[model samples]
Target: MTKKNVHTVPSKGGSGWDNKVGGEVVSHHHKKETAVEKGRSIARANEAEHVIHDKGGKIQQSNSYGNDPNPPKDQR
Candidate 1:
């Protein structure tokens, strides 16, 4: 199966946020939280993985939206 990854990254010049897919920017937001939410929505719609990064460009969190091979016990 193909992998879909939606990422929330920091925009240049310390302005705001950027949502990207496959290294291409898809949308820009004025807030990190908003960007994260948008990324989550995109991930869910596409059954992809959402990746959130810190301001320092370090990975902060990741969540699978759907088609998880090893879902949580509660979800299963």
Candidate 2:
């Protein structure tokens, strides 16, 4: 009777799924993907393909170092 001890019982009810496209039985429990999750997934997929944008969301100009930094080399 307890959920913890319940086994797969098809006669009354069971934790079974109907293998079908857009099945209500299966989709009911699953939550819809949020915008954040979708974005993260897209970012991950893009990273695998080495696609990324800088802070300006644009590729840095070729060989044009922006705001070049000089860390005072060997200045003791």
Candidate 3:
């Protein structure tokens, strides 16, 4: 089964951040930090990926909580 990834993106009004799952907004926050934290929790719980986007609508970073297809070589 495929798990839907969670994403933290800028809100439509440009006033805050939003936590989205499969293109649907699940939560909203005034701070990006809060949104990211919430998104991470959701992704971890669902064993999905947490994707963060910049204000310009570009992907900033992504964290995988599930079985990664391409894991890092260094298992630090």
For all the candidates, what are their Cα RMSDs to the real structure?
Answer: 3.0, 20.6, 2.3
Of the candidates shown, which would achieve the greatest TM-score relative to the real structure?
A: 3
**Candidate 3 global lDDT:** 0.94
User: What value does the lDDT take at residue 38 in candidate 2?
Assistant: 34
lDDT tens digits, residues 1-76, model 3?
A: 2489998999999999999998899999999999999999999999999999999989999999999888989868
TM-score, candidate 3, is: 0.91
Question: Count of backbone clashes for each model?
Answer: 0, 0, 0
Q: Report, for every candidate in turn, its global Cα lDDT versus the true structure.
A: 0.89, 0.23, 0.94
Per-residue lDDT of candidate 1, residues 42-70 (tens digit): 88888999999999999999999988877
Please give the lDDT score at residue 70 for candidate 3.
87
Q: Name the top lDDT candidate.
A: 3
Residue 51 error for model 2, in Å? Answer: 14
TM-score of 1: 0.84
Candidate 2 clashing pairs, residues 3+ apart or interchain: none
TM-score against native, each model: 0.84, 0.20, 0.91
